[model samples]
Target: EAGVAQSPRYKIIEKRQSVAFWCNPISGHATLYWYQQILGQGPKLLIQFQNNGVVDDSQLPKDRFSAERLKGVDSTLKIQPAKLEDSAVYLCASSRGQGNINEQFFGPGTRLTVL
Candidate 1:
């Protein structure tokens, strides 16, 4: 199976600029997730979608971030008017399901640098 795909791999932007990242889940997978990983910290789930409907997004910063899954396939995450603290790795991941046999597969990530 083909692994997850991401773009740019790296991004550098000044404070208050908007940015967006994309993700495509594994074929036949029904669950997708977006996470923010700060330096020296574990990945924090920003949002989760179970086939186009959001299952969880409590951790997402609604003021600056928004996400969507179109056609229940690929997804995109956007950060508007970013802050200096937003410099971190934005990781996209997907899982077949919440079942015991399912495992989350992560993409390489898009590293954003705010200067």
Candidate 2:
């Protein structure tokens, strides 16, 4: 099976500009997630999708961050008016099933640097 894939691997943006990152999860995985990892901190869940339905977005910064999982497969995360503090890695992962999945495949991530 294919592993999760994410791109640009790195990004540099201004504090008020907009940027987006893309993800392609492993085929046949039933659950997908987007997470934000700040320097020296664990990754925090940003959004989750079970197929085409959102399972969680509780930690996402609604004012600037948004995401979508269309067709329950590929997904995208976007930040508008990006903040200086948004300079962190945006990680994408996926598992074969729902809750209690023992493991998830992770992508290399898009590391954003807000200038």
Candidate 3:
């Protein structure tokens, strides 16, 4: 089985600039999630999607962050007017379903640096 794929392994941008990250999950996975991991901290879930519909986005900063899994296969996360505090590794993960015991596969994150 193939793993998830993300683009632009690293990025640097000035404060208030905009950036976007792309993700391609494993084929057949029905649940996708985006997470933010700061240095020295655990990953925090930003949004969850089941198919093309959003399941949870309460932790996502709507004012700056937005994400979508348009075809239930690929996803994109964008941050406009990014702040310094938004610097982190954006991780994309996927699972077979919404079941409790599903194992998640994560991609190499896109690391963002805000200057």
TM-score of each: 0.95, 0.96, 0.98
Predicted model with the maximum lDDT: 3
Per-residue lDDT of 35-112 in model 3, one digit per residue for the tens? 999999999999999999999999999999999888889999999999999999999999999978999999999999
Give the range of the ten consecutive residues with the poorest summed lDDT in model 1.
93-102
TM-score-superior candidate, 1 or 2:
2
How many pairs of residues collide in model 3? 0
All models: lDDT?
A: 0.92, 0.92, 0.96
Model 3 misplaced regions, further than 4 Å: none
Candidate 2 wrongly placed segments (more than 4 Å)? none
Q: By descending TM-score, how would the candidates be arranged? A: 3, 2, 1
Candidate 1 residues lying further than 4 Å off, grouped into runs, are: none
Question: Between which residue pairs do clashes occur in model 1?
Answer: none
lDDT tens readout by residue for model 1, 1-115: 9987777699999999999999998898899999999999999999999999999999999999999997999999999989999999999998998665889999999999998
Best by TM-score: 3
Ranked by TM-score, the better of candidates 1 and 3 is 3
Show the colliding residue pairs in model 2.
Answer: none
